[model samples]
Target: MKRINLSDKVITALKSDIASGKLKKGTKIPSEPELMERYEVGRSTIREAIKTLAMSGILKVQQGSGTFVASKIKSETLAQRLRRADFEEINAVRSLLEIEIVRLACLNRTDKDISAMQDHLIQRKKAIETDQQQKCTDADIAFHVSIAKASKNKVLVDLYQNFTSVIRDFFTKRKEENMTYFARSHKWHEELALAIINRNQESAVQLIKTLLNNNY
Candidate 1:
């Protein structure tokens, strides 16, 4: 992993404080002198950190007044907050996005997209049969990503790709707890593939919702 600089560390600490309600919205952050003392950093490092946070919409800097938490942060800032969220919270958001992906995929998928999804489903089944947890997880993510691509929406595809880590973490934790998770997942993948291929929009949506809900 790349090393985090002192300024980045300061940004993360401030963000954590804000998220934990220690620094509420519109609350003024510590002054430069106080921050330098608190973080044991020099003037330049503290100024750079504050500038970075302000640019990211996590902070608002005033010429005369001290820096305060922004009243409204960017959506990307909100996504950063969600990155630290629990599995259930992440899964709930994933399910909502993927349900729409499935609906659009059923309406828009091409033959090639369907073929790719089929291949991913086969890969998932084989990985599960061989008890290859990592391969199974990769194939499962690819299967959903294939559906996202079939939706013909670049933004949706990118959003799903961004969620890949959270999705993988969720799968890894569940598989560790339940040995049969992948086996059941393989069956659901097969059903989902057929639903998308047949253009069964409702079935595709419900199948994905069920899979995310662990009803498979």
Candidate 2:
């Protein structure tokens, strides 16, 4: 089996052990070598599983000490949960996030940030012109991700990155005929970028709202 699938199995096994009280919270887990022996996988696969669980708040790793069970119940990360969320739910949160991001970006964006946003928009336009749905979707997300980074808020940038992954998945699953949305919204994205470059907070926020209203 592939290493990714192997790591997933290890993660599931570890979670099951924790849920079953076999690996109690606050208890140190088996060493890397021990885990490798048990799962019959390489050290890298076991380490990847541990890392993923650690990020999700299931396991905790201490440098030079050991890995330990942090939670008895599985705590799903935002990225994991977002995959299961519907478009309406994701969009509602995204709308709120984008509005705030654009507002802050307008105030905080630097020449570098503006240049990155402009580059993504250029790629987005090219993707649309080529009728490459997946590339268009990627470029669209990149454009907004640049905006989020310009917010000068680390938390917002992380949340938007995770949330946009879900949006990217949603876009990929869409039929070819449904991809007009990306093309239609390209102009609005250009306008939003310009608004941010001009540091027009009100106009940036309103343009984001318009994009959201039009289901872009």
Candidate 3:
């Protein structure tokens, strides 16, 4: 198997995102040179990266109009493809990003942000106690998102939102196999909430990492 180059790491993200409609079908991505610059990789790596999607039939090369996506709407979305991603790989990236996000959020969160998070925590608690697992799950997401939003950085919020969808789906399936997961999640989230509220950045980041790594 050919290995992916570290510098052009964006190749996979771009390909999957284009197929997922995050980049939008029919939308022309930046040219080979632009991608190479962004990824800080050589020309050959960029070409090889583009070749992956080309081979997958998701990208169509038109001589004048440039590469266009497969016109079918369903095919443009990569949710099905995401389902096939290696969980170990996904979790590794998730861990790296979320830890820092929580750290930043702790430093930036305002009093109002704390209030919003508290409200989400309340909703989360009520949902679980009332046996509304689906609602509880959603509330759990809301709580984490509120914290990310409190970071006062749009990029973190956006990336968190995108990746968390996949993470949420993972937990949802895990729930089907093990119902008790929610209770432990509740306990951990409580600690997370308190850590963020206290502006204890290290504590918040640590708890978040612990909770995330527990899945494995």
Candidate 4:
């Protein structure tokens, strides 16, 4: 079994405490040292966990004042909210994201970005040939994420990264028989990389539309 990271464990413990009302909203949390001892983790682990909670709006950090529970209910991040969306809804949003990503990528992409896409495509092909479902899913996502990065839009890249987690889950739940889709879509993916490399903005955009519409 994989060991959970220490900071993640602390985060879960803290959230549980909040949910049970042991750490009520508006109450200041223990000092860093106290938290370290309570969780039996190092100071860095405690700090990392607290920082994550703060980012999620579960905890409020006031410099020199200490941290407090901002809400008994954890504020949902966009990625968390996305987990509830159906595949169709997520794909609709994906279409919007990728269209703009490809457009920007065509304009901004560097040779390094093109290399990343090509490498992922190779991994994708190898995964399909070896019938490695997980690798195929990873490479497919990576290929698109490379495009998002190539676009030079940090916000778009972050959004796509979150959206891909839900997509990864979708890939895992699929029946083995559905592996055929990966095989069939490989050529389209190859073409997409080529279009991006060639800086053919229109071709890249059209390919993305077709890829998304085909439900691949």
Candidate 5:
């Protein structure tokens, strides 16, 4: 078995402490040196572990003061929880939401909504051609958000917004890691957009599913 990284091990220990109430909410965590000695890890590992906890809202760092348990520990928002979720879990939830979004958008989308998606699609293509990875990711997400808005369900739209924020990190990380799972597919995107524009619910749902499962 692959050995767990020191930072990850420290994170696991900290999380366990919190869960067991050994580290209560609003209580300060042990200082860096204390943590390093306790876990037998170096300063860098301790800092990295703390950074991960901070990002996940499990811990809060007060500059020049110390790290403390967040006031609202383990009660992470949906977006926050999703941010910490594995890619498979995030993708599964996204696929479920987007399938409904495509179907509803096909039934309820206005011409303006179609135009918005088209504009974002154009932007995405441009970003891809120029090899602007971040821009491409932004435009692609914008296009999906436009589709969710077209569904005209406020709850679904809000959920999609939160989901996008969580997934944006996935896109960025994949790009950095040289993974093609989330790469842009202009052709499929255009086809899906056209299906929504034409009010073809069946086609739109099929296209969206195909696009998501294509893994490229």
Candidate 6:
């Protein structure tokens, strides 16, 4: 029983250490004897804990070469990061980042930019009614991408696209969902389009933040 508890305890501590970068990637773990002494656990428990972590892709165990944090495992890309990233929290990041982008776009967006957004909104409306769900998803992505590009800063545009992919992944992995989210999202985006067209940068920023917070 002590061994079982120790195994779990060591696993948790090791995971925390790895995530904090204290146990750097590709750096070998202490020997079983060392871990047992440091943790005050039996060798078997230490071994078992290491084995579990290795199986989970959190560690690499090379026979005789010793156990090390897996090089490919990164806290930023891990579930630990997502545990701290609540839904719509990303929208806050977007609001902060994009508010400035909108200000820049106000100065930079050309007639072509407005035309592109109009075409995107049209397709988005049509996609919403279509039976193909994937088309609807693509249109949603495209609408946002167009707005980001209108900022005329290629870096901001790319960053927003990256963020969009992550947000979409979260939504796709959820259980029960409602189309009401889509309807509300579309309405808010319409407001967003109008604000941009008028070059009301501040209103566009605030409206996007409000829409993200309220839409759920």
- Provide TM-scores for the models: 0.64, 0.66, 0.64, 0.67, 0.64, 0.62
Error of 4 at 8 (Å): 31
- After superposing candidate 3 on the true structure, give the runs of residues whose Cα lies further than 4 Å from its correct spot: 1-84, 177-179
Better of 3 and 6 by TM-score: 3
In terms of lDDT, model 6 sits at 0.75
**Rank by lDDT, descending?**
2, 4, 5, 1, 6, 3
lDDT of each: 0.82, 0.89, 0.75, 0.89, 0.85, 0.75
Q: How well is each residue in 1-216 modelled by candidate 4, as lDDT tens digits?
A: 112499889998889789778899999999999988887888878888889999999999999898999998655688887998877899999899999999999989999999999999999999999998888888999999999999999999999999988878777777475469999988999998888888899999999998888877
Model 5 residue 178 distance off true place after TM-score fit, in angstroms: 7.1
- For model 5, the local distance difference test gives 0.85
lDDT of 4: 0.89
How would you encode candidate 5's per-residue C-alpha lDDT over 1-216 as one tens digit per residue? 122498899998998789778899999999999998999988988999999899999999999999999944354477877788887987888899999999999999998998999999899887777778788888888999999999999999999999988767766656764224334468888999999989998999888899778643
Q: How far is candidate 2 from the true structure (C-alpha RMSD, Å)?
A: 11.5
**Tens-digit lDDT track for model 1 on 2-83?**
2238888888788878877788898899888899899887888888888888888889998898889995433344455567
Candidate 2 lDDT by residue in tens digits, 45-64: 99999999999999999999
Greater TM-score among 2 and 6 belongs to 2
| Worst 10 contiguous positions by lDDT, candidate 2 | 170-179
Model 4 TM-score (2 dp): 0.67
* Window of ten residues with lowest summed lDDT in model 1: 71-80
Residue 189 lDDT in model 3?
86
Candidate 5's error at 106, in angstroms? Answer: 0.4
Q: Local error of candidate 3 at 94, Å?
A: 1.1
